[model samples]
Target: MQPNFFIILSPAALEDLPATYMTSFFLPREEKRFLNRLLSEFPAITVIEIDAIVEQIQSIVDRVTQAVELVLALVVASGCLVLIASIQASRDARMREHALVRTLGGARSLIRGSLAAEFAVLGAFSGLVAVVGAEVTVALLQSQIFELPANAHPWLWLLGPIVGAGLILAVGLAGTRRLVSSPPILVLRGTQ
Candidate 1:
């Protein structure tokens, strides 16, 4: 029976053989034609090309990349869902505090703005810490592992805070819209 797989012999090893051998070379697009001609003429020769092997490897890489992207999407979606759930869980306490502020003569818009600003500041601070940690980690990896120069992107530091703040503010407000809009009396009375 024919084996399901075959071991590939290196060119160096094959060249050491003590028998007469024939080699054929073909241009890029003439591989199939040459392969067909050889199969018809010799009936036992095998054909393979560097380009074909490289193409197969590239296809595998593309599949792995697609799988990584799908996993990343799932992780991000789950993180957002967790964030929303946590905010919802804290709604009652947040409403009580907001009610107290309102009862103490704070304007409704002021309370909402303050909460948004607070979340944004927290996000910005967290982003700054994250950037610092990432910079240090990358620096270590580059210098020790890869033996490369450490590169820093100043724009990333600047943009990180803004992006973090904007995202947190948007998500926080979206998740707490009801708590932010309800009047102090209704919130205190637990009527809405």
Candidate 2:
């Protein structure tokens, strides 16, 4: 359909304002012929293909998503290194504490359970914080960056604590295995 507009605006009011005027055409078929005719009639008019523009936008979004994923991977790796370092730094303290516990009539099984519980609690708390951060990040990325509806990952809430606790427990137990197995006398002697 051909559309026309007759605007009567005085030039003095908007003389300094730069404006872009666009005319849209709706066609059932023969769009190429129509565009060619329109272009031939108006050579100064610029024609932009909506489909091409959309493709370019999608390509940009894909690249951005990849970049975000890479950043997330780096962040995870950094967190892992920090966790290991902190555990290593506290190794001596943990050994001494275990020795003291043994001296105070704590059984090996009791020590193991307490250690497991501590690690699990730490992991769960961290996981909760991580989940909260993740959810906020997701919400911001979706609504602000990606221009999409915010998603609340309910399943993530359920899984985060369990996964965190399991991972921390496993790592903590592995790092402290020798501390539990060794006699308190040896550990106490080393600390001296």
Candidate 3:
């Protein structure tokens, strides 16, 4: 027999297909019965090959995943740079605070502890805001643009906040090391 002709039928053509062919795709029960009748009359017609459809879907999924990964990497890198710059700029203020603590008889270790705690709180707050903003954006896009269900995984919420907080904490601590190590008097004099 000749290669099966692929007839791409619209939803309106559902009533014309046989039940056997209709069952291969997602059709209502009523549509399936009507299709069964048509297929019984025409044995030559087969529904589209499922394997080909699956392969096409998989290819699309792979491309989408790659694109998403690339975008995510760029976003993360940008966030890191912004965080580093913000922390670096605030070093002088932090050093002044550290110097005050030292003058008040706080040890260097205690000064470091205070800085870490401040950064941790900042990280947590920033993470919370970022997560909420992202969730709202995704929800809006799904409902308005995609016209699809807005179901986000729990892990997304958890991961975003955790990652954001961790990134902030890591960058803050690393970037402030120089300020933390300087002499308290120099920091207070604004000489460093």
Candidate 4:
């Protein structure tokens, strides 16, 4: 039985309780032989090996960790795909806008700054959302599924936005580098 299911009481207070209640023990490897002897001599006595329980718990934790990692990788891959598709879909319109901006005295630095700012805001907002979602999931998993105390990870607050902004900036700049660097006249002509 889990510790959560019952409260400890004096023997006299539990006189009405059944005799079939269980007691758990922790013993060293050498002492396990003592437990085995006791179990074999008394058919009613049962001894469960802690090593087996630990191995089972570790296996479950490992499976859950792998599943979470897989989900995260899939999310990142899908986000990249969506980002690329959005950029490609807007390429023609963006080229025209870039040409117009440059034609009206806007420098390449202006376009670069505009692109960087757009990506940075998107990344930061997404990161903030991801952090919140992750913390909620963790709280649920710890308190309900694992029956453990819930704790907050402070590092997520710092790392989430930083990583998000960095990733978005790298991909966004790579995709838009040509828009910022191409000759405005050539882009205008191509658009026409």
Candidate 5:
């Protein structure tokens, strides 16, 4: 006859009884201590091995990490697209204005300088908005999320808008070359 062996089970163990029982055997020292403490209060039970608990925790971590990385990639792609579109639109808009300026006796260098100045102003404004938005976003996230710490840096805020403005200026300059080279009469007539 087999010796009667007592089994200690947790609430989670009861839910997964079939699987737990399939792997049930002798308990480790830590598990035995926990079981003894549990059994002292309750009567009948089954014990879950530590290996299963460790595996479940590891699975949860892997899933969460995968989800976070997917979200991060999506955000980066969206930002890149927005920046590209903004630069393209800015270049198109400035090309027409630069053509008009050249028609009205504006020097080529002056037209370029004016566009650069406009871009600088836009960049400064965007930088200010980004800084403010970052502060507000960080504050809100810190207040709402559990176990999350505020970790905003000033350089990121400064860089984003400066880069945006520089990109816009660069694209605008590239697009205006044809307009700048055209004769004033042709520019005025909108021929090319």
Candidate 6:
């Protein structure tokens, strides 16, 4: 019986078919000459390659990647700004604690190190919560809305806390630059 529709076959697989009804031609480094001859001989035949289809898929993937990166950058920028504002707002309380530490003869390095460690811990805690929340949300969406199998990314567990701590430390330190530079007495005098 005649086939209902023609199945596209790869050029590489042409050799696998029997030579009775199927005609296989090989023209080394003369694809243009071969195509010209084939079309002239059988102008009604159609030849299609998967390259165009694969290129379309690749283009879609690239666009998705770019959109994801843009979104991630916006989120990180906004998070940093929020972090900076929070730290700056709590500056008075921090200054009082630092002044107390200084009165107790705490060294400059000690105070700075303590602040850095505190911020790092805060960041790690925040990251841990965020990761857990995100994982749960994604799992729910996958199982309920999308009806797909949900999988966890193990790297997120490790990376999230580390990145969070680093970002918090960086932004917190930058926000408290004035407090870091000023003497405790000066800060206590309300002139800072």
After superposing candidate 6 on the true structure, give the runs of residues whose Cα lies further than 4 Å from its correct spot.
Answer: 1-48, 133-149
Q: Which ten residues in a row have the lowest lDDT in candidate 2?
A: 23-32
lDDT string for model 5 (96-140, tens) is 677778767789899768767766676566656757876878777
Overall lDDT per candidate, in order of appearance:
0.80, 0.84, 0.77, 0.87, 0.67, 0.80
- The reply for model 3, stretches above 4 Å from the true place, is 1-47, 145-148, 189-191
**Better-scoring candidate (lDDT), 3 or 5:** 3
Which digits, one per residue and each the tens of the lDDT, describe model 3 over residues 41-101? 9878776545567899999989998998899789778877987898778777878887888
Q: List the residue pairs that clash in candidate 3.
A: 17-35, 18-35, 18-36, 18-39, 19-35, 19-36
Residue range 108-186, candidate 1, lDDT tens digits = 8988898898889966876687678769987998999989999997988998788768777788788888887888899
Clashes of each: 0, 0, 6, 0, 3, 0
Q: Model 4 over residues 1-192: C-alpha lDDT tens digits?
A: 355575778999979867765777777877767876787888887667879889999999899999989999999889978898899899989989989999999988999999999999898887888999999999998999999999999999889988888888889899888878888888878853
108: Cα error in model 5, Å: 0.5
What candidate 1 gets wrong by more than 4 Å, as runs, is 1-26, 42-46, 121-165
TM-score of each: 0.64, 0.64, 0.66, 0.76, 0.47, 0.69
What's the C-alpha lDDT at position 105 in model 4?
100
Candidate 4 off by > 4 Å: 1-25, 30-44, 143-150
TM-score of model 6 (CA atoms): 0.69
Global lDDT for candidate 4? 0.87
lDDT by residue (1-192, candidate 2, tens digit) is: 133666678989788988767766555444667878888998988987766678999999899999989997797667666777777798788888988999999999999999899989988987888899999988998999989999899999989898888877887788778878878898889953
Top candidate on TM-score is 4
Candidate 1 or 2, higher lDDT?
2
